[model samples]
Target: MRRTAISTTVLALTFLAVPATAQAQTQYTGTNAPIKVTLTVQGPDGLLFKGKVRTKGHDVTPATGGTHTCDGTNAGANPSPVPTPTAALDDAARVNGFTWDGTWYASFDDYLVESVKGVKSDATAYWNISVNGTSIPVGGCQFKLNAKDTVAFTWTTL
Candidate 1:
């Protein structure tokens, strides 16, 4: 009986001495933070349009709607804003070395389709854009315009 007690005490002590193999497990890494990119488009006027594009991995929130600050030169310029498109074409023309002149559509069908034809200063690419966001992808850049990138365009009414 004494030997049995001693062995039980030893086993208990051994078990107590052994550190608990399982502790609170925590996941402290491999988290992705959200990314935001702003794309501003201006025409003959100042601050034509501004958009905010945001994305996390494959999830993206394209531009839904925004106001356009029509210049005095534009007809019926009374803050007659329009619906913005979810995405715009980031087109580049080859003639002027990567000049961007792309076009963007609006969420509302009535709004005039924006036609952008300019040179992207940052990339030096000439582009010709139309209403729909359609263009050949270049520079391994996926044509995924997030919600943060505000896009705008202007044209003289014929």
Candidate 2:
């Protein structure tokens, strides 16, 4: 009779511990956590496009470090590189039906922003990138993303 009681107690404890362990293991990591990126396209007049893009399903990770750093991830299952700023623009375009055009430079995969919402970069002003008001040292294609990042592409001489 004592053996039966001990067995039942042990089973109950095992059942209780399983859920706790599972929850801890399955908790959200950078891979599964929801990420939000705010994007803005500016022209000489002021703002052209601004919005937030969020994804919770895809695995997103921050870049290690440096001027060439930008958030990157695979597309679904493909191993191809996708930069955070580029992804943000793509997300905004998909969400709002906004059209954006860019030109890729050499073999670096760097993108030069040409136009957004019909505003073209002219001779006097060129499109430039900034994050949270600070100019990005790297090109858009190389910029890595962190969660809730603010990415801006402005057309100005400055």
The candidate maximizing lDDT is: 2
Lowest lDDT 10-mer window, candidate 1? 22-31
Q: What digit string (tens of lDDT, one per residue) describes model 2 on residues 15-60? A: 2344444324322224434478888888788887877877333222
Q: Tens digits of per-residue lDDT for model 1 on 20-51?
A: 33111111122223335454445544544444
Candidate 1 TM-score over all chains jointly: 0.22
For candidate 1, the lDDT comes to 0.27
**Candidate 2 C-alpha error for residue 23, in Å:** 38
Go through the candidates in order and give each one's C-alpha lDDT.
Answer: 0.27, 0.53
TM-score of every prediction relative to native = 0.22, 0.60
Single out the weakest 10-residue window by summed lDDT for candidate 2. 58-67
Best by the TM-score measure: 2
- Any runs in candidate 1 off by more than 4 Å, and if so which? 1-34, 56-158
